[model samples]
Target: MATVQFKGIVKKFGDNLVLNGVDVDIKDHEFVVIVGPSGCGKTTLLRMLAGLEEITDGEILIDNLLVNELHPSKREIAMVFQDYALYPHMTVEENMNFALRLRKMDKAEIASRVAEASNVLQLNKFLKRMPKQLSGGQRQRVAIGRAIVRKPKVFLFDEPLSNLDAKLREEMRVEIAKLYQRLNATIIYVTHDQVEAMTLAGRIVIMNHGIVQQVGSPIEVYRKPCNLFVAGFIGSPTMNFMTGKLALEGEALFFKNEDIKLSIPPYLLSDAKKHDGREVVLGVRPDDVLVERDGEKCSDKVQGVLEVCELLGHRENLYLKVGGMRVLATVEAFFNRSPGSAVTLCFNYKNMHVFDKATESRISE
Candidate 1:
């Protein structure tokens, strides 16, 4: 296991800056994930660390050694790419031992490494089978086994599960997590999937347009996003946003839009006071929008016409039109309602988020 560090790393294609002054320190034996949408430079950062791409400015260190100029083989890292990248003519055993052969490792030692990795990956039964004969998930396991045999100081996974089906991806996620625990290896994974990052990473580095938006645990990023981008990007079904302005009424602050009004919770008074009368964006997660039961009384309630109801097992996503803005709520699967039906929802203001309109940053506690 090894620590990885990126010091003011920058990448540029001609005049197009891809990564800008990025700095991060990954601890030894830590499973850190860099995740974002495509073209966000997550892969570029990973490639730079792998020595596959050059750093236009700044340095990369592995285990306290500056490796900006080090060859890929000298970086003591193994990368598992999106494609399985297995040789067609080679069997699983051959594929696993190829790197060891290239390094002129002893035959017995190579066999020992292959046996152990095969056992760990449950690929022993398919050792004699060629890549062409293996299923996608099996082939992926073989690819992982190849990396495991190397016993590199750091493991770099670049969307390794992207090719697998949804079910296979979920299974592979658990398998990879177990692999990390078994080996206690320092791993840096890159993916565009936030779900993968949230589940696998000890710390997630959220990036967008070549800039890091936030870096923290999944719960930290989800519960307290630093800006509007993160709050909108990290959650499923996306968070709902309403444009409004703060208004003062006695000691209470109210958020007012055209025909919608929601009282700001007292806990956020200190933060809301600074932006009094200024336009702001009110954010609430789908789960936080409670579907009011019949005759239930709530102080912060809004009525909307149900537009769509997607019945997902255990939970349903209800799309509604509140005033002129669209809102989504995750409710019990049993809560059935047809389109055009009027529904009342309670806004859990205690869990609500308020963002400054000008800067698109969170202003509420």
Candidate 2:
């Protein structure tokens, strides 16, 4: 296990900047997942750390040793690629021990490592099977086993679960989590899946447009996003955002848009006088949008027309139209409401997020 640090790292391909002035400190035995949409530089950052991509500027350190000039093979890292990258002709056992074989390690020691990795990955039954004979999840386990045999100082996983089907992905997720507990090695994983990042990471690094947007534990990012981008990206069903202007109504502050008007609780936004007439965006997650049902008394309910109700097992998604703007409220299932039905909804102020529209930064305390 080793600590890894990136100090002002940058990557450029000709004139296009792929990564820009990124910095992060990964502690020994920590699992950090870099997550972002495609073309957002998460994978490029991982490649730079693994010594696979050149750093146009800045330094990378492994256990406090500068490794920007080191070769990939000398970086003491193992990478599990998205495609599995198994040699087709080789059996599972052969593929797992290929790296040790390349280094001309003792045949007995190589066998020992292979045996231990296979046991950890539950690949004993498929040891003699070729890559083509194994299932997708099984092949992924083999890829991971190959990495385990290297016993690298740092492990890099680049979307290793992306190729698997949804069910396989979920199962493999549990396996990987178990692997981390057993090895406890420093890991840096890159993925576009927020679900993976949320579930696997000790901390998550979110990137967009070649810049690191925010870094935090899963719950921190989910509960308190730093800006508009993160607020909209980290949650399922996405957050519902309403564009409006803050208004001063005597002692109170209110948010008024063409579609809706609601009081802005002082506990959410302080210094109400300063925010008067400020253009802001109000954000609430689907789960936080409380749609009134069965005469439940909800404070500050605003009326809207139900446009659609999507039943998703135990939860239902209600797409509604409040004047010209749309608001989505996720509620308990069996809503049994038809389209065009009138509904009343309000936000759970405790979880509401207010962002300055001009800067796209969170303004609520």
The prediction achieving the highest TM-score against the true structure is 2
Give candidate 1 regions above 4 Å deviation: 269-271, 293-299
Query: Weakest 10 consecutive residues, lDDT, candidate 2?
Result: 292-301
1-365 per-residue lDDT for model 1 (tens digits): 89999899999989999999888999999999999999999999999999999899998999999999999998889989899899899999999999999999999999999999999999999999999999999999999999999999999999999999999999999999999999999999999999999999999999998888899999999999888999998989799888889998777888899868888776755755666798899888998888865323333778888998899999999998988899999988878677899999877765678889999888777
Which of the numbered candidates is closest to the native, going by highest lDDT? Answer: 2
Report the Cα lDDT for residue 19, model 2: 90
The global C-alpha lDDT for each of the candidates, from Candidate 1 onward, is: 0.90, 0.92
RMSD of each: 1.9, 1.6
Candidate 1: Cα lDDT at 261: 89
Give residue 159's error in model 1 in angstroms.
Answer: 0.4
